[model samples]
Target: MAEIVLANVSKSYGAVPVIEDVSLAIGSGEFVVFLGPSGSGKSTLLRMIAGLETIDSGTLTIGGQRCEQLPPGQRGVAMVFQNYAIYPHMTVRENMAFGLRNINLPQAEIASRVADAARILEIGALLDRRPAELSGGQRQRVAIGRAIVKEPRAFLFDEPLSNLDAALRVRTRVELAELHQRLRSTMIYVTHDQTEAMTLADRIVILNERRIEQIGTPLEVYMRPVSRFVASFVGSPAMNFLEVDVSRRGAERLVTLPSGAALPVPIDLPNDGRYELGVRPENLRVVPSGGDLVGEAVIIERLGDRTLIHVRLADGRSLTAQDSGRSNVAPGDRVALGIDRAEMHLFDASGRAWHPAQAQAVRATETA
Candidate 1:
């Protein structure tokens, strides 16, 4: 296992730059994930680390060695692609052992490594089967087995589970987590799936428009996003946003929503600035009457365990709130929504977040 570091790395396609100056340090034996939407340069950045793509500028270091100039074969890394690139003509055993043939290793050593990898992956019984005779999940295991036989310093994955069925994907995801614990190898995974990143990563690097947005643990990014983009992207049912005006009353901050509700939040704000209020669906509550946020339930999604109510405010703005699974409210019903002022998020016009302090200040006096 080895630590990987990218120092001000950059890449481009002719005149169109894909990755800007980005620096990150992945500790040894860590399971890091690169997560983003399509065209977010996540895959391109992973390729640069694997030496599959050229780094237009900056340096990449692995195991304390500068390796940006090294060829892929010379860099100690193994890559697993989206499609399980196993040779259809070769048996599972042969496919896993093919890479060792040119390395001048003894035949017995190669067989031992192949046997060990198959055993660890629970594919020992299918070693003699060709790729055509195996299932998709099995084929992916063989691909991973081939990488394991190389015993590289680090492993890189590019959406390795995208091709599996949903059920199989979940199972494989658990197996991968177990495998990481067993091997404790350094791994960098790239995916557009937030679920995969949340479940598999020690740290998540959120990328947007070829730049890193926020790098944090899943909970950190979810709970205290540094920017408006992250707050909107990390959660399942995205957070709700509403334009609001900010004012300072003594030492407290007051926010006036378009719905004419004045909410005293636990965050410091400039006396005058364009700000918006953000609240997660789970934090917003639907009340029978006299809620701070008055709205009509335009859409109700019953998810069995919980219900999501899309409420259209009087001012024509909309927000969603998660309610109990047993909620009997239906669409077209008039309801009141209440929010925890302490849980609110304030974002400036520039999409920057203003976090509340740990110690709560005195509440602002009532405003007309």
Candidate 2:
């Protein structure tokens, strides 16, 4: 099995810590992505698993073998970096065969491995071409082919597609997914792009401030974020936030928005004075009036299929709501927004999320 396990792994450069007390268990053949903003230690964590970086404290086991004390070459893992890392002078075939030659593999065996990798990466036609003659995507495929020839227990990719243009990035991302399906090998990828994480990963590990903030499938984190950081970071256009007051009206829990509209929340919270209301842009629609909140449209983005209306409330808070593509709303127009109550999330003072369904289930269990 190619499963990897890390126990309380902590790493630091002198006094400043990078990854601290991080533990994870990656199942065999799993495609896991480390996702976060820059300097969030996602790449560092991947490097640790690849044996490129040392951990100050913890144990790392890869494919059932302890590897923290081993050197990178000894670890049964291959890494592909952000840059293609292919040599300018060497042809694609030579670049892929270099490592095997270093280990003194027989010439015939090396040629067979290179040919198989080229077939797998669909770069056989470019086998004799140097890096300079290849496109950015081609060079990246060569880099992956080099790792594939190693046939390592696991593959680690560090933003390998970041160098490509938008279109190439999308194409290469699909190729990577197909590669994983064919190989069924454990793969760990690192990237700051949430789209890549959402599309490529079987599970996403979101790192924040040198530690993991959340880990789950893309939809899990998108639909039921555990905290404000996740709810704000995972979604495009982002989740809107507004400070709201809470009160218990008989048996119903109500939240008062800045627009003076009172809405009922399913989850029964504590004697709440204040909480943050989080609603995604897609969860809101342009309404005429008497909605959850009313605001003035400050900006309108016509994005083909859907339009985004940025509204500014009287209290100076801004929110973005989605409208029809042919929306007649214009900038500075008075626009009201209706929210999806089931998709609403509440964040307490500590930024912890209280999902209605989860909280309702817990409440039932508590009284059971």
Candidate 3:
């Protein structure tokens, strides 16, 4: 296992920039995932690390060695691609041994490595079968097994589970996590799926528009996003945002919504200005009596475990709240909703985040 580092890394095709000034350090034996939208440069960054794409500027270091200029073979990294690139006519054993054979390793050594990889991947039983006869998940395992037999210093995966069905994807995800645990090698995985990123990564790198937005554990980003973009991008139902005006209510600051309901926020304002208030669906509760906000339920979606309520506020802004699945709330009900003061998020005019202490202060003064 080795550490990977990128300093001021960038990529471009003529005048169009794909990635820009991205710097990150991946610890040795750590699993890092690059997550973003389709055009967000996640794949481009992965390719740069694998030496498939040239870095227009910046430095890349792998295992304490400068590797930006090295060829893919000399970089000591093995890649598992999305297509499960296996020769259909060759048996799994022959497929896994092909790379080693090209380098002219001793016959005994090649057999030992292939056998060890097949055993590790639990593909020893199917070693003699051709790729045409294997299931999607099994074929992917073969691709990974091929990488393992190379005995690389690190592993790079580019959407390796995309071809599998939903059930197979989950199973393969678990297997990949176990493989990392057993090998304890540095692995960089790229995927556009947020669920995959949340479940698989030790730390997630969120990229957007040729730049990185934030890098943190899944819960950290979900609980306290540093920007409005991250707050909206990281959550499943996405965060709810409403525009409000800030005002001084006695010694404390309060945010008055367009609906004329004033919410005590825990933040200090330089002046009465416009800002966006963010709340997660789980943080908003349906109240039996009264609340600081009132809205009409526009839609209700009931999942097995939870119910999602989409409420259109008096001012015509919409917000969603999550309730217990067993709770019977129908569409078109006039529902009162309360915000959990401790779980609120406030953003400045520029979309940058404010500390929670500010939000707490506002809530305290309002309650007082």
Clashes of each: 0, 0, 6
As for candidate 2, its clashing pairs are none
> Rank order by TM-score, top first?
2, 1, 3
Best by TM-score: 2
TM-score of every candidate relative to the true structure = 0.95, 0.98, 0.94
Worst 10 residues of 1 by lDDT: 359-368
Candidate 2 residue-wise lDDT at 362:
88
Candidate 1 lDDT by residue in tens digits, 1-368: 99999999999999999999999999999999999989999999999999999999999999999999999988899999999988889999999999999787899999999999999999999999999999889999999999999999999999999999999999999999999999999999999888999999999999999999999998888888889999998888899998888887777667887878777777865546668788999999987778778788999999999999999988788899988999998899888888887788988888988777422332333221
Clashing pairs in 1: none
The residue-by-residue lDDT of candidate 3 on 1-368, one tens digit each, is: 89999999999999999999999999999999998888999999999999999998999999999999999999999999999999998999999999999999999999999999988899999999999899999999999999999989889999999999999999999999999999999999999888888998999999989999999998887787888988888888988898888888799778887678788776665567888888999998888868868889889989979999999987788999988888688888999888887788878888887657655577788899
Q: Each candidate's root-mean-square deviation in Å?
A: 3.8, 1.1, 3.5
The whole-model lDDT of each prediction reads 0.91, 0.92, 0.90
Q: Model 3's lDDT to the true fold?
A: 0.90
Error of 3 at 7 (Å): 0.7
Colliding residue pairs in candidate 3: 265-362, 266-358, 266-359, 266-361, 266-362, 267-358
